[model samples]
Every structure is written in structure tokens, then in C-alpha cells.
Target: MEKLIDCHFHIWDLDANYYPWLTDNVSENVTKITGDYSSIRRNYLVEDFRKDIGDLNVVAAVHVQADADPKDSVKETQWLQSVADGSGNGMPQGIVARGALNADNAEEIIEAHCACPNMRGMRVEMHPGLNAPADYNPLKDEKWLRNFALLQKHDLVFEVRAASPEQTKDVIQLMRDHPETNFVFPHLALSIWRDEEAIAAWKRNIKIFGELPNAYIKLSGYGLFGLGWTTEMVRPYVMDVIDAMGPDQVVCGSNYPVDSMAAPYSRIWETHFQLLDDAGITGADRAKILHDNGKRVYKL
Candidate 1:
């Protein structure tokens, strides 16, 4: 197997930490892209993750925040850092903790997260409502933008997801406003794979995002493409992202545990390899998407 660096994955201890989505009854408000998530609701420690990967040579991996309680955001980072320090596996070499950019204590929380040795960045979800106007978008809110700039000060990555056209444009503007802060777009901008028209819009928005020097995209969360999704079914979506953002700006992640609902860890990586091969991305370029870009982007 080729070397790998999983830019996205999660290892949550349900008993140790409180996760509202996983613990509380599944909310109807949550999007059901992959239908039910009953299979991955339990704790997924480093050992469990290792067992899943088995022999795959994951040189390093990033642990994106798994929606722990807002009050425990910094606690989550410290806990993961401890896990990385003790696991000896050196998995989750980086921790992308959570911080609500609009919260009054956002900067204080960010400072606490950065204090952790494994702190790399944070994923502040900008669910900019469907087709929200520039004036109404939360991302453009004065307090939020001021707090978002804290990431730049710490030289941290901002892993974001933008679903609507207006939100994508807002992200583009945000990038322009703060070029110093690196942006990693996860889950193919959380595309609506079931709709070709939505995919077309995603393509247009992704192309615009690619033009920004600070923007990067992660190819992950195939499970979100819907249950029983084929490699062929999602190949065009993958290719379009690469076409827009080149190998250098793109990175790959398992979106594991969550994606485990769709397929095994090995199968997930195999699908990623197949998708890249289908796109004719081989040699160093292939290495870039697989692990190199991840190493550089996450400083693993």
C-alpha cells in the first residue's frame, strides 16, 4: 500500500466526553445524507482506529473536532493531545479543535486550544443558511470576523464547509479579507451529490475558491455521497475538485468512523486510490494528494 496521511478522521470517547448529536436522540434537524448513523455512535479510541486501518501506512493523521459540547471545546483538544502523547502510535498528529467564532469567549477558547502541543487548527462551521445574502451572512458579522482573525495570529488552519452559492462567495470574500489564515475546505464543500445542478454550482464555487492562494480542499466523507455509493458515482465530483484546485492545493482524509458506516477503513483508502488513478493522478502528484500535501498543510 502507498504511504498515507489522513487529513480528516475522528476518535471520540462517548463515555469520557459528551457529544450532543451522538448521545442525545438523533435530531431531525441534522442532515441525513448517509441516513442513519447508529453504527458509529460508540467510542472510537486510537486502538480502535488502528485496528480499522490495520496495515495501511498512515504516517500521520488529523483529528477534526467531533462536535463535542461547546463548553468542552478546549477540553476536547487537551484530551486529544493527551491521546496523541500517550498512544505512541503518533496518530492524530494534529488536532483541529472547535471554536465558535461568534461566541463572546472565542478568542479565549482559541488561546486555550493553541496552548496544546498538537493544536493545528479549528473547524468553525459556517452554516450560512440556504442562499443567505451577503448582508445577512453570519460569516460577515463584525464580531465573528474579528474573532476569526485570531486563527491568523496563531498561524492556524481554518477548516470550513460552505454549502450554498452565497456562502461560498462569502467564504471567498473572507479568504480575500484574511489571506494570512489558511483555509481547508472539507467534504468537497459538503456537496449535494444527489443533484447534478447542485454539483454544477459546487463546481463553479470550487473553481472560484481554487483561485484564492490560501484556499485548500479535502477529498473526504464519501459516505456523505449516500449509502451504497459507487466509486464511479462520485468520480466526477472528485475530478472536478482536483481540476479546480490542482494536486498541490488538495488533500485527502478518511472521514473515518463516520465514513465507516459506508465501508471499511481499507476500502475507503482503496476507493480514494482508485478515484485518483481514474483521474490519471500518479507519481509525485498522486503522493501529494495522498500524504504530502497533508504533511505540509497540517504541519504533521
Candidate 2:
């Protein structure tokens, strides 16, 4: 198997700022935030990545935006890129920095981020549960289109996270409208929480969007949906996504830090291996999902 390129890892220091979502008390049966940056510092940097990867290779990595201060987003990208450049660990490959694409001056926000050499894309957190209601509708708002157009102008990929199936369609439509813009749908549209009917609908919509050459999906974050902490439980969902989207267009993501709350980093990696093994995918295809596709998408 090819060494994996974790496309969706998150790095943060809670001491620096408040992560409102990482609540101290848990009303729901959600995973407790570990708030550990030691392992990242110790394990994820260039030397650590090489050690963990061993003979396996990491072609590139795309840093998915963490929900932090917008200013910190750019700063984090800069730091990661510097680490990559200094360590010769692939130059962070590509950065999906955070931005409020629905805001009035969204275009300017994107341009400012695009100015960074490592910034290859923008990750807009459109989770209606976390963001304003208006952001959920990218096509409905003129400003969102303007921001999207700016991304197209810069040739930056669009990484989107949506909480609902309907929102997936809205994003697909937006991508269709701007055929030139590349769209990466992270966490399988966050569909693991959906009922059977909803899953079917999402699958159908995903198939529709899969026809679009510019659209891609990241196979990450399925573990967050279930209370159970096993790779086996997540297999069916991951397999269903791979079968629907196919391996070439799909890439692996750890969704770390957030995912670490439920399972350790090692378990997360194991779960991905289990999914690929169960699917009986070839080494080349596995390599694509593991790293190459991400390299291509991020231009790393």
C-alpha cells in the first residue's frame, strides 16, 4: 500500500484561543476534546512524518482549514508552509485557508489569502449549525458567487463542508454554474448522520456531481458520526462513498484533532486501511486515494 497523505488534518493550540465547539461538559455523547498539541509537534512535523511513513511516501498534503480566528487561518498556513519548506516535507503542498465566502467583501478576502504562495484553495465552513443561515445558500447570494468567481479567477480549488444533503445540492449547483472552479467536498458531505432515505438521496446526488470533472470528494470524518469507536463500524459508509465516487476522484483525510477526540490518531489511520482493504482496491488506486489525488487537486 502507498503511504497515506492525510489531507484533512487540523492543528491548533487551545491556549491561544477559545474553540467554542470543544465544550468542557458534554450533554451529547460526543467525544471529549483531548487538546493535545504535543503529538502533533512531536509526530506530524517533517521528521516525524518521515518516521511514521517509513518506506511509504507522502507526495503532498492539503491543510484543511480549522475553525479558528480568520487571521490565524492565514498565519497557520504560513507556519505550516514554512515547516514543509524547511523540512523538505513537501512544502505543505496546498493550503485551504478559512474565509467567509458569503460576506459582502468575500472576493477581497479570497484575494488576500491567495496572495500566499502556499494558499491553493479556500475552505468555507458552511455548517448551518455553526455558521449563519445565509451562508448555507451559496448560489442564492450574489456575494457568494462573486467570491466563487474570484476563486475561479485565481484557479483556487473550493473545499466545502455542509451539514445537510440539500446543502450538497446547492454546492453542486454552484460548481456547475462555475465549471472552471474545482470543488472538493469534504467528509462525504457530512452524510454519516443521515437516515437511510437521506443516505440514498445523498448517494444519488453525489453520483450526479461525480459526473462533473472538476468535482472531488474527500473520504474523511466518518468516525465522528457514530458513538462507537471502531473502524469496522465506519466501513460500510466509507465503502459506499468509494463505490459511488470511485477511488480516482476520492482522497484520504484524517480530520485529526477533531477526530482524535473519538479515537486515537493510530486508530484513525487503521480505520482508513480497513476501509481500503475491505473494498479490495488495487495498490495504484489506493495510492491515488492515499496521496496522488490530493497532490493533483492541491497542485502539490
Candidate 3:
């Protein structure tokens, strides 16, 4: 059996009233942080995750923010710590909670999450495709950058997602501007490798992040764009990401529950390994992607 740190997975309780997007009335497709997600309406908790990753030899797991109300983001981390305390499963050793980098209360929220023994960092999702109000456009604002810099002071990581490669380019300055705070870019930064122009631009964007030692990228969410991702579809892009970021800077995440909608948990890991194997990623280097990188980056 292979051991892993499983950098990403999500567990939510519909009974908690924390997740607005998980409302039971979601009979049709609903847009959460990711995209049009209709299949994940059901409540998913720690036990459900255990079942999904059954016998996969996960040494630990990192729980990223699950789009719960921002007010309850700290509480969400507390609840997950409780889950970890009781699960006896040796999972959820780290958490990436939510906090608006542009908010006046950003430091308060960041400090609150930092108090949690398991909290690793914070993430903000800017969905430019939806024209998310004036507030979501804080990436370039001085106040947002000021609040964002607080992550370094507290030794916390920053994870972000932009709607397009062009938007990703806009973050390059932020990464270089904040060298002390580490950043994690997930899902090939939503690169559409099938298109030549998009892939070329994505490579350029990725290369910029690669130059910044603090920036990291997660090799997950291969099918996030509703196209039903396959290894063939994701290989060139994944390899390109590795080429830019190198194995040590790359971490692999299951993006479970959300990714499970497109492919089962086991299948997702299986195909990801196949991609690595084909790319000639060494076994030791493979261990870094599957486990060490996550443990070191997340400080699990």
C-alpha cells in the first residue's frame, strides 16, 4: 500500500447550517466556489471521506475551506478539529480556512483561524466569470495587499484561484510582491490545455509562479471545467506545470467530493499516479508530490 498526505478533501455537515450552497433545495445545478455543482448536494462528513478513501493509505489530510459562510469559517475549522479529535483516523491534520483578504476584519479572522492548532492557512476564490461584485475585485487593491501580507507575519499560507489565465497573470505581481508568504495555486490554475493559445498563456503564467520560491501549485481538479477530464486531456498541461514548478514545488490533492462527481476518489488518484508515472517522475520525487510537499507546505 502507498502512503500519502492527501493535501485536499472536503467534509461538510448539512445539519450545521454553515454551508449556504449545500441547501437541500438544490435539486438543480448550483454554482459554489468551483462551478455548476449539482451532484454534491448531499451531506458529507468525516465518515463519508473515510469510506471514499478506503485503504488508500492516507497518512493525513488537509481540509481546505468548503465555502461555508465566512463568518463561520473559524468555527468550521473548530468543528473539523473536533472531527479529527474523534475520528481516530489520523486524517485532517491541517486546514485552509476562508477569509476575505480585502475585508477590514481580515486580520481578526486570520488570527482567529491561526489560534486553531490544525489551521494551516486561508484561501480566497475570485470568480471573475460571474462578475462577482466590487469586493471580489480586491486582488490589486493596496488594502487587500496590506491584509494579505499579514499571512507572512503569522506564518500562514495563501491559496487562490482565478477564473482565467489572464487573471492568473494579474496575481504574478502579488506573488513576487509577497515573498515571505507562501502561496498555493490549485488545479493547474484552471488551465485549459486542450487549446493551444490557452495552454501557451497558462505556461507563461505558471512560469512566473515557478520563479517565485514561495508559490506552490496543486495537481488536482483535472476535470473542474465540466469537460470530464482524462489523463490524455490533462497530461501535457500537468507535465508543463511540473516542468515550470518542478516536483518539489508541486503537491497533489484529491479535490475529493467535488472531483468525485466526475470520477471516483480511487480513480482520481489512480489516474494522477498514471500521469506521474508516464512523466518519469522518480519514486522519491513521487513521494514528495504525494506526501512530503503537502506536509512541508501545509506544515502538517
Best by lDDT: 1
| Candidate 1 residue-wise lDDT, 1-300, digit = tens | 688999999999988788887899984434455578877778999999988989999988999998888777888888898888888356679999986787898888888999988899988766534223434556668998888889988879998854455467677888999998889988877554446777677878888878888889998988887778788877887889989999899999999898888889988888889988888999999999999999998888
RMSD of each: 2.6, 4.2, 2.6
Best by TM-score: 1
lDDT of 2 by residue, 66-117 (tens): 6555545556566666665776456466788886767776776766677678
In angstroms, give how far residue 298 of model 3 lies from its true place: 0.5
Better of 1 and 2 by TM-score: 1
For lDDT, candidate 1 versus 2, the one ahead is 1
Model 1 lDDT at residue 198: 71
Worst 10-residue lDDT window, candidate 1: 128-137
lDDT of 3 at 47: 86
TM-score to native of every candidate shown: 0.93, 0.81, 0.90
Q: Between 1 and 3, whose TM-score is larger?
A: 1
* Tens-digit per-residue lDDT, 1-300, candidate 3: 667877778898877646766774442324544466767877888889889888788888899888777566778877887787877354689988886777788888888888878888887766544324744566656887788778888898888855455566567777778888888988877543347788677777778878889888888886575547677877887888889998889998888888887888888788878988988987789999888999899998
- Name the candidate, 2 or 3, with the larger lDDT value: 3
What 10-residue stretch in candidate 3 is worst by lDDT?
Answer: 24-33
